[model samples]
Target: MTDSRPRGRRQAEAERNDRALLQAAREVLAADGAHASVAAIAARAGVGIGSLYRRYRTKDELFQRLSALSLDHWNAAAERGLAADDPWEGLAAFITACVEFGQGSLSPIAGAIEVTEKMRAKSDRGDELLDALVARAREAGALRPGVTAVDVSLLVEQLGTSPLLDQLRRQGRDDLLDEAAGARARLVAIAVDGLRAVHAEPPPGHAPTRRLYTERWRRRPEPAG
Candidate 1:
């Protein structure tokens, strides 16, 4: 009979290498954005460059895997937000989670990768959850009328930049880190307050429908010249 113990050990080692590579990729990409080198990732994982190549033949392959993981994480956070009993609270929590994700591990890779159909589908589901959150909040009179889901989406994108936090980190100003950490939250609160019905005036023009919003917001490829 063929000895299988050696084969099993090799398989287990392969799995461990894969996990290490992925974890390293997450950290490197988060810190260095799309410009992160494969060598850097391999070094971070304490794996030989040859080993990384064995697992992921190319950088694009690695990036695609990371993108998938990010999508799964985003879906989980969205689900948690939907689970909250309070609609307004749920919306806020979801926005916060999204901002955190964008500022953390996945933001750089997310924008760098080609948008696959699978990514589009996941985005559609996310949009649906956002729609429900906004609708519920409006019904409860927590959100103002005429504030479309697109508006919230835009606000979240703006918050994801984390300008103050980034600046503080870059400056290594530990004294201000605590205050900077709350900057996004404070801005979000302000935006939400501004979105209140009592603070807003009536729109001059008709608001776009959901279909229109989706069509306009969806990223399309530029036509070949």
Candidate 2:
């Protein structure tokens, strides 16, 4: 007679494989960005290429799922900010969290995925959280009167792209690496100070939404064969 096992075992194995694939994809994509190969991800996951393809028909589909995971991360960060007792602290935490996330897992997926309505909705929710934090901080006289949520978001994005950090990582100089690692945080602190009410000045124009920035910066889709 054939050996028998519950159907649940197969389902559990499938779930484990899917989770492993996603985790591996995140790690590879974080280091290599959108150009990272599926083969690399499969190898990292210790799964066959056929296994990955069985779960996702195309690379785009896998990227889409990764994008969703990134958005969930942002949303969770926002929730933490919203939960903070001090409005200014909450806003600062939110900015720091976003910058850190971008510098790590979110960057590749951000550049890779095709924009979808579901992704847009998640981004909008994050924006809403930002708006709330800004409003609270402004009312508390912690943030400058003219500082908009967009300003904070843009600052995080700018700091997230630090060349010094990239250069240090490339050079592999242990002595300089320690200093370079703190550079982003130091810059974030400086920027946060500048957002105080004491430095208030009118913004030149309306700040662009996160959606607009994503649309402008997102990589063009690869051509079909």
Q: Pick the candidate with the highest lDDT.
A: 2
lDDT (10s digit) by residue, model 2, range 5-60: 78899789889999999888866675677788999999988999999999999888
Model 2 per-residue lDDT at 78: 79
In candidate 1, position 201 carries an lDDT of: 68
Show pairs that collide, candidate 1: none
For each candidate, how many residue pairs have backbone atoms clashing (under 3 Å)? 0, 0
TM-scores of all candidate predictions against the true structure: 0.66, 0.71
Candidate 2: C-alpha RMSD to true structure equals 4.3
10 residues in a row with least lDDT, candidate 2: 103-112
